[model samples]
Target: MTIAPSRSPAPSGATWQRADWASSFRNVGTELADVAVTASRGTIPAELCGSLYRNGPGRLERGGQWVHHPFDGDGMITALRFEGGEARLSNRFVRTEGWQAEESAGRFVYRGVFGTQKPGGALANAFDLRLKNIANTHVVRLGDQLLALWEAAEPHALDPHSLETRGLSRLDGVLKPGEAFSAHPRFDPGHRGAPRMVTFGVKSGPRSTIRLMEFATADDPAAGVQAGQLLAERHDTMAGFAFLHDFAITPNWAVFLQNAMAFNPLPYVLGQKGAAQCLASKPGEIGRFFLVPRPGSAAAERHAKPLEVPAPEGFVFHHLNAFEDEATGELVLDSIFYADFPSIGPGDDFRSVDFEAIPEGQLKRCRIDLERAATDPAGAVSSDWLEQRCCEFATVHPARQGREARFAWMAVTEQERGNAPLQAIEKLDLSSGERRVWCAGARSFVSEPVMVPRAGTGSEAASGPEDDGWLLCVVWNGARCASDLVILNAHDLSEQAVLELPLAIPHGLHGSWVAA
Candidate 1:
């Protein structure tokens, strides 16, 4: 089914400007408890019942000092609950140890990983290698616990209902203190049996080590089994510094791309620049794809070593999905690739960043022949462009994860090309290369779109069309000076409802949908 490219028209008399986009970064100071929200445009779906949780850097300044980057700001979580054709909103800040300490002192005592330094000069900030757990990247509900995750440190647990902080969690002792747990996790729909969650952590250095872990879900059919019980764990060490943020997985293999980038921590150690700003791409360097076998797969016993295949020149922060083609014996990976690493310099203001100056993420498809990889590794991999437009934060139906999928929903730029703020939600048909977009307006901006399948359509007992669902997205209403929860029909990019939010949520990094 081919869907021709089309876009929803902007609101009458609405004009887009840099200031309109910048207004979304303002700090939301107050927290609300169960505030009812009303739809301003359409009626809410009666069948849609669940909670949408989002996390991001909410507070940008403290003690009259602004963070050098938005990523350095404090983490805030927003919960939007829908039930019986009604919705209520609530938000709270995760009270990490660092957040509590700074609140009591009423000053900047910790240096941020993204270049927010204390009042004292370089002497005071120098050589302090302690990393404060910001807990600002992503949120996930595993079994009975809700965890706010940061890639650099342990996740902070919170009450799934009240949004209250429950302190740091060690995954029931699966993790130790101060260990790195990744923010991005892939949910496998269980090709073999019960579903499982797959995640990884990295300890990067001259020789980087990656620890891959899998956990059983609370929805397992087994009686009296606890959620988050570690199912499998494996550690692998590879050459070179690894700055991996996300990875892709199939039924049998976990795939990671090691970008050809060099990191120099001298400037960061001297308190002159952020740690991320110290990385630069290596010219003429080709990336590599590390394919590791899963714990209980057919390839696990025979291939105890990870196979490395040459990758195309680019950097990937996120992958859409991956699947193994049974007929061709090839593993297919779909990912968004940037020409280079995007960084904020010491003097650059994130609010005023030039979108055109940085590289845009374009989606690409790569196919690796497993049989050929065992012999001629260099020539086993091949790739081509899938979507050459400016887009990010893409997702497929939960049931189609790590499997062949035909549809994807993501936030995209309003224009056909070039880099800009994401202003619309796009539904792309991967089979036919067609797309449909629903734009809020010229001045409005958008966050990631989460696709929630309609109940009983696709589940363990049955299967349905991949696009039979709803797309929930948080949109910044620049004209209203607030935010809105925009809901669209997954079958077609049509507005189903728009719940006006009293408070504006800062542009978030990631979110998840939990069915009640």
Candidate 2:
């Protein structure tokens, strides 16, 4: 699910802007059939031969009734393919059982996790335990499967080239019926050959159960993955119920930070609030982290004996990257953290959220000392602010996934300070204190940066020089009510190209770059 800030009690600042932003809030129901995009600005890089795939909520409403929250919307697959100095675009909705049923009925027939209730309210929603398999969170290519994933349910497979739904995938039976697979999986860059994917799923209850998985494929010399295969699997149980979205993985460890948010199903059971809306962060509680040894590693025994540490996990939704410092032996994990749980109220609408009341995520770097954590919890770790500006969805070069990299990219608010809509992209230097930003005009909305290394620069020496390629991101053009794929030179954050589309794609959550 998307961790968007809840609606603030106060209204947006007085001098209200025009409602033209409603265009972006509208659903882009159009499914363009591989439309060739002509560059509106600079030329497309000739060496850029790959497809940039993005996933997020597309169809936000049914039968003229808006969803209680954007997370209730249906997942849309957007593909931007580049080859021989040209780009082609195609989009389609993930036709899951829930999406198809709602489309056929022309109204909401299921209760949403956030707050959308049945039209008949209490009577229509009470005693209903069915959850919609809305595969709107993320998209990933595992082996030959291009899966549209939702953390709570099995992934829906789709055709990579045509964005066609191919039914729910079972990962070759790796996942049983109704089994969950997390959407946010970490890529182990330090793996010998091909990068190993590390992901986890949770079954929360009195004795919460967590399963960790590892997958890999043969490293293609050309950087194109042929197929993925599962390598390892491990399951362990925790003490209490927990909420988890993303995790950080090192060479030998996978770290999960469990938030202190409590879920009271009383309201949900009584058909008053949705499941997600009933979660509230407990006061005066410092969350903890569960560090398990990664599967297929020398320290595999440590998987059953996870190291525990007190952390300000508060409500961390995403981990940018993590790795162990060779000299210090300290595990450094950088994450996007918020001050409190991003709560969803029953009547809240994210689009109408008050900027003043929302707490923005700041980039934080935490240093973990296992030996110290074993003796005293307080001295086990130390955290320092890396960048204070409100930021989220920070990404780095793919080669630097499990290592300390010099550069990081993120979507940030346009203003110099305070929280607002994301209208700019920032490049932060991890080693030095320098920062660079590329602002997408005042009215444009930019998504996460997908860094694609230039062709022929696949060698370690070439990628070591950070920013040797291009950054691809989607920017919503408010004036034209369309979207543009803006390509920026990673080195200096200069605009390289802009490919505009005829229709606007709703702001999305996560995206990936798969080489052709």
Candidate 3:
């Protein structure tokens, strides 16, 4: 597939702004997809987290490239901020022990070609002993401390402003043995109870199990962590499920998603033997979901009954945003899923991996309509997953603070053998289960569009009146030249605006928006 040009015709009745960092990479004619955005402080690096805070649609202003340093790891840039003409970013990269590239075995050779599983031929013959630098699960800022939970690595204390690791919790027996952990961080501002910390862990062994933990940030800092009292734990083993992708939390309930690790699919695709041989499994694997009570309360149970989710094997997730609907106390979850593995194989060159088959990617919406999970909590996925052979890489956008209005944006590709070519952005109505492709072409693959709320549309229009509910998206034109950012109306997905950057961005991952 050809990477589109970095320019587009401006859309009607829509306004767009291109940041400064979108012009650095030379788009090498491959569609730049999987673009995610977030707001943060400090220089956002070129990797996933750094790119989130990248300046869109402009030339890299001298030191802009310096924002994304060499050390940063893969994590979501969920938040970002740009002020005084400088961009700052913030997010957590899980740090796990013995899980780096050096630890991974030699690259997996399929059909005489090699796919990068790790750097070395084998750990015994490898040069770097450190393996790969594992990242953090999910982290959030609470006053001065940035609380993050990891299955294998130590829980780090980072300065929210500088994004530096200042201290770490001496995690000893609390960490369960596994390939990785699942618990993601969330900020629960106290409304009825004290603040709580929620996390999940995957314990690996003959039988893999998923564990959930909850604790408090304001508890006595001098007091040593109490395994039974300081946290709540839950375990489950259906299909030997352990790995969890992303999760969502409401005031009273927490939602869990399994196997949502998008860009980090190396371990899963490499098989358990490959994973164990190389220490690729950090904590969580085989994505599964659970629901537990928020930490720091009288009702806290030592091991809360984890309401399981309906995530199946071989389906990986990206993120899950949970919200409570007024009409029903039940929680609604919006998520993105990669239904099946693309039959990808490495070419003679490392620059590209070819897909053996075209993926019919899909976006799914599931609602937990009961107080407790009925049937198998591990089976909470929507019915669509049972039918579609393949699904798209998708992002969920909630509109007007209502679940009914939530939208799912996906880039569904045309199926090929090893890798299917991603084609267009299909907008799905969560409530109706209907989908529409606002923009589609074999030459292009659209990233998650930035759903910008127009300002002063009486705050209810909330997205702003400038375009009356619109989406500002970076559409990568597959042209040999630069790429483009196109804005569309969120309500219609039909009206569009194109903003052309002066240069092309090399194929990258997620990015976010910053209101200047």
Candidate 4:
């Protein structure tokens, strides 16, 4: 397939300005109650009844001191409830232990993993290996409970309706104290029984170990905690430190990409830099792909070990989708790759970052002949670029996950090339390489788009057309210094409604949609 640049033009009079974009990073200190919001353009679909929950860094500064990186800020959640052709918005902080302590003392009391240090310099930070769980990556709902997730620590359970913190949860003893639970969880539309949620946890050291877990969805009320029933768990250990943030899955396999990077903890141990800053990418090294057979699968009984294939030379953070090609006997994986590790150096200002200096993420497709990989691992993998444009946070319909999906929607840069803020949402047809885009004007920025399929289209009974849905995203309107909830037709990138929000939300990481 030959992909081309989008021909759809930006909104009239749209122009990019750095100052306008930078205004979105300000700290928001107030928690908002349910505020009635109406669409300023177009009309809300009457059938659209669900809740949109988003998680991101909400506070960038404290006690006159600023966080070195936005990732270090405390977590804040924004919830939007759509019902009867109207919407209500609410925002609240996660209120983690660290956030509570900092609020009580009115200063920075703990060091952050990304580079926010304590007030007393190196003497106060040295030898302090304790990490503060900011709970600021993603928000997900499992059965009747909602969780605020931070990949480095246990998740903090929140009241689904009020957005109130209910303290940290161990998933009914599935996770031990301080165990890592990944923020990225893939929902598997059931093939045999009921739909399940698949997620993993990693422990990195001289040798890294990955623990894959599957839980029953809300369909099973008798499950643990009325939702997250642990179905199957498996572990695989690999050589070298694994800096894994996200992964992909299919019906029979759990896939992971071990990027070509090394971690040096000297700086972090000595209070000179954050733990994430210690990672350095190897220039000419190739990555390795680990395909672990899912527990209770026929492949697990046949092969006692995972199949390792040589991946292309790049760093991957998120995957669009993965599937097993039954006819070709191959496993295909689609992901976003960066040329190298993206980082902000110590003592540098993150707000004034130069987009050109860092590598832009591009979508790529990798096909691995599983039969060949079992015998000849080195020659089993081949890959090519799917979309060369700068993009991230791509999603397909939930029902199409771990299957052949033809359509995908993601946040992309407004320009045809080069790295910049994601100012638009693009719909791509994988087979035909056709592209459609809806730019939010140059002064606006977008978050990850969540595709909510129209009710009754795709479910356990049958998988419908991929694009029969709506794309819900939060847009930062720089012109008005506020945010807007924009809903667009998934099939064609056209605005359906734009509900003006009362407050501005910072650029977020990830979000989810829960149907009412």
Candidate 5:
């Protein structure tokens, strides 16, 4: 796609002044209410069907007070549904206790995990450990239910058709009240044709405890799932402190990159800081990997302990994909790795964060030699940095979720080396050493791109590569002070269409595309 330069005047900020990126932090209070999406560039592809559901912080302030961190903002869900040759867009906020109470009283009522403090000083916040589930991290559809997810707590169910909050979901009694469910659920297109959702929750301490689960969604006549039903469960105990946000899964294995870190709750107990602020990385230790077997796998029958592997001393927040090579007894895992946990002290302002000083995530390919796993799991782990271009929010063709594939796409920075806002979408050809970038330049920041398989049409239908699809994502256009849903050809990284919106959406983290 052709790169575009900024047309609007730059906005000012206190610290590093990147005008385009600075606008991504602005508030998007009004909902779209099912508005028709108009394309300004090219025609919408006929093969592209179904809605692109995305979630992130929308409202950043309560009354006149600003939130200390963008992650603390209220969850806003956006759906851009594509049909025949047109698009329909709608957005809504997931109503939660904190959102309702703060809106009703016209002020901040809850302390957020990141740094949004209460009205008074630390004195008023002291010893009050109550947490309000923000439900702002991700959105997914399984079985017959639509859910807005947050990593630390249960998901809030929403009406998929109307974007209305229904209530909290318990996975058909699989999860009890106050149970923790990971927001980052990995969809396993298993070999048996039984697609399952895999996720886990952690309780970190001296000896951390992990609860892993696999659940199947009930299929309805409409071809949509009704709700997720429990299929399997396992409890594991690991040594040392554990902080897990995401994991990767093959047909019979689930792998997690656990950062070596320590948690101190004293400052949080004294109301001086949020619980997240207390986490400190163990500088001298190597990062670890926890590999657990699937319920029906041979390892499970033996009641085997989780295979532990030591990795390069660093941190990993997200993984692109993974697959098992049963013939070779190797597991190929590709993920984004950082040198350390990127953080700031309680006194620092998140809005003025120095991007250059923070560690940028680079793609890394890790190979686990399962043959040597039992005797020396740590020594068996080997990794190599794929590319130096800073990137994150990586994805691949839906059908290639847990298999060896040619390409992986993700949001990348405009520059080649340093850390900056993600302003482009990169297509990394793993088989070949070629790369393609579709950049909107310094004026537009993007979200995670969701790939949809091209429907069978004419000649391309019978047997096209899995990577044959269109890439869809939302872009915050700083030039227009608005947002656009951009579409690109996955094969060539060419712009197909740009559906412009009247308002801007705060840059979001993750999203999914459901086939029609």
Candidate 6:
């Protein structure tokens, strides 16, 4: 973990300009201000003070209709709820402004926030959850009931504490129009306690399935206005399956990553507008990895079957999760993407629009073995990508096992760059592949790493209640756009405590802590 470079001086900015097609790009912004003052854990502010939501993208209208991008939050905070220690956020006060985005047409999207232990008091008692379009994924509370799923071109169900809607389901035979519904409506929480919903569809055309629906909530909302049985089916794969992102489930098993038609991305955003006739019949994202099993009976269908993982003829594996390791029944499968960097050049725009030459991606650990993947769930156990440097945002800190199953992620190497800078925050000792970086450059864009367990210290015969894990995180500091919260020391993330958050929280994507 060697990060030394700090001659400082380069944080000025018009957001660090450089986009009109890269113009020869090279603004590592003073090694990203010495990797945010060495992964900042204390004083590091200057100007960039946080907050930047804007949500508006996905469009096509003009009568062709494709819209769908609403989630507005113009006031700020788009969705953050850390619970107990307090963090509840949801800004954008009811704005929608139609959708036709040429690039985020009207902006202002927030979509969620619902805390209650009295942190800042009434923001309508916290529980807004917007989205007249887009906003699909991660609202799910189930157990006190709070859930949402929308695609706008029709497919709704909101009411995470009164974001109110409760029913719409018109996939008109099942999804079409520019397709966009990546499933995150998951919740199995056990049999009679009731809670099960899983949706995944991203088909722009022929054959691309993964639909599993089942909502429950009936006590007679007028004989049925919302909840209970939509049961929608569809899942019989292998035919060059089309796009199907992130997935992970375990009440038996249900994993996904299908992508063949070149792992489609809407033909590279319609080939960046020139609409190259369909980019030679599309195949522009490169994909592979499909494993499904989990329906019931026969020992849970022999522990869920259906497997096919094969890639390494050009690389392409993004996000995917499932980490069940009950005394080695083994299922660990984390992921990450962006490849090609044999020294960068293809399309070169300064290593492809500054994503910094890709490669610096890897952290694959597989060992499925569910009764030999139930007869070849892709031939069970074996894979790699175990860290070669240049990583980005990895996470797996649910705290488990005989300790030592922690991972923190967020690296940069080559002495940090700018506008994206993240320099260090490692920690992966998984069985002994050893790694440790406990902070190196303050606020370089962190956001995901919430463990926070530390209470009694576990083991009083183990039933569930003995703490020792703290990690929490927020980082950011994009030249002071502000952000800090840190808390480290989950068995030594280098013992820390930063805090400092009064406001300035605009860059968000994945978050959830709940341990109040």
Candidates in order have lDDT scores of 0.87, 0.81, 0.41, 0.88, 0.81, 0.40
Clash pairs, model 1 backbone: none
Per-model TM values vs. the true structure: 0.96, 0.93, 0.54, 0.96, 0.94, 0.28
| Residues 35-154, model 1: lDDT tens digits | 999898888998899999999988887878888888888899999999988999999999999989888998878888888888787888888878889999999999888999999989
Off by over 4 Å in 1: 1-8, 11-15, 219-224, 460-462
Candidate 6, residue 486: Cα displacement in angstroms equals 20
Where is the poorest 10-residue window by lDDT in model 3? 59-68
Q: Candidate 6 overall Cα lDDT vs. reference?
A: 0.40
- Pitting candidate 1 against candidate 4, the one with the higher lDDT is 4
Error of model 3, residue 251, in angstroms: 3.9
For model 6 the local lDDT of residue 507 reads 33
Compute the lDDT of residue 70 as modeled in candidate 2. Answer: 80
lDDT of 4 by residue, 413-435 (tens): 87778898898888888888888
Cand. 4 Cα-lDDT: 0.88
Compare the candidates by lDDT and give the number of the best one.
4
lDDT-better candidate, 3 vs 5: 5
3 or 5: which has the higher TM-score?
Answer: 5
Off by over 4 Å in 5: 1-17, 218-227, 457-462
The residue pairs found clashing in candidate 2 are 143-228
Residue-pair clashes, model 6? 40
Report the C-alpha lDDT of model 3 over 1-516, residue by residue, as the tens digit. 222222233344322112222222331222222323232212221221221232221211121121111112222222343333233323322223322222142221111101233323344223322223233234444334544444344555555444445545434456533334443444343424444455555654445565556555455456654322334555555344234545666655566654533333343344311221222222344555655554443224433555666554445445435666668655565555553543333222212323443334444546665444556454444433311323343544423322234555555443322234443455555555565555333344455565554434543344443224445444455543444455555555664444444335433343433232
Q: Candidates sorted by lDDT, descending order?
A: 4, 1, 5, 2, 3, 6
Candidate 6 lDDT, tens digit per residue, 356-438?
43354555655566556646654565667666555554554433311224444444332323224343456555555666655
